[model samples]
Target: MTVADGTARLCAPAPGGGDLGLWQRVIDALRTADQWGSSDSTGTPEIWAHITEGQR
Candidate 1:
C-alpha cells in the first residue's frame, strides 16, 4: 500500500488461497508498530490514522 496526495493505494497479487488471517495479522502488526514508532518515542498515530482511514 502507498499513500500519496491524500489518497491511499494498494496493489497486491490475486489471492492464491493463502491464509488471509495471517496476512491480516501481519498488516495489524505493521500498523501497530507504525503507531508506536521507534522506541515508542516518536509515534505518529494521527498521520497513520489519516493514511489508514477506510483501509481494512
Candidate 2:
C-alpha cells in the first residue's frame, strides 16, 4: 500500500477462498484514513512513480 497526499494505493496479491471480504475491509480502512482516492492496480504509473521516487 502507498499512502501519500491524503490518498492511498493498495496493491495486494489475489486472495484465495473467502479472504476477498477481508481484503476489502483492509482497503476500506486505509481509504477511511486517507480520504483522497484509492486504486488496486499494481501497474499504475503513479503508484510506481511514488514508490520509486523514494529509492532514488
Give one digit per residue, the lDDT tens place, for model 1 in 1-56. 67886555443333234789965664675574313222223442222223444544
Clashes of 1: 0
lDDT at 33 for candidate 2?
39
lDDT of each: 0.44, 0.46
TM-score of each: 0.29, 0.28
The candidate maximizing lDDT is: 2
Which runs of model 2 end up more than 4 angstroms from their true locations?
A: 1-18, 35-56
Question: In candidate 2, where is summed lDDT lowest over 10 consecutive residues?
Answer: 45-54
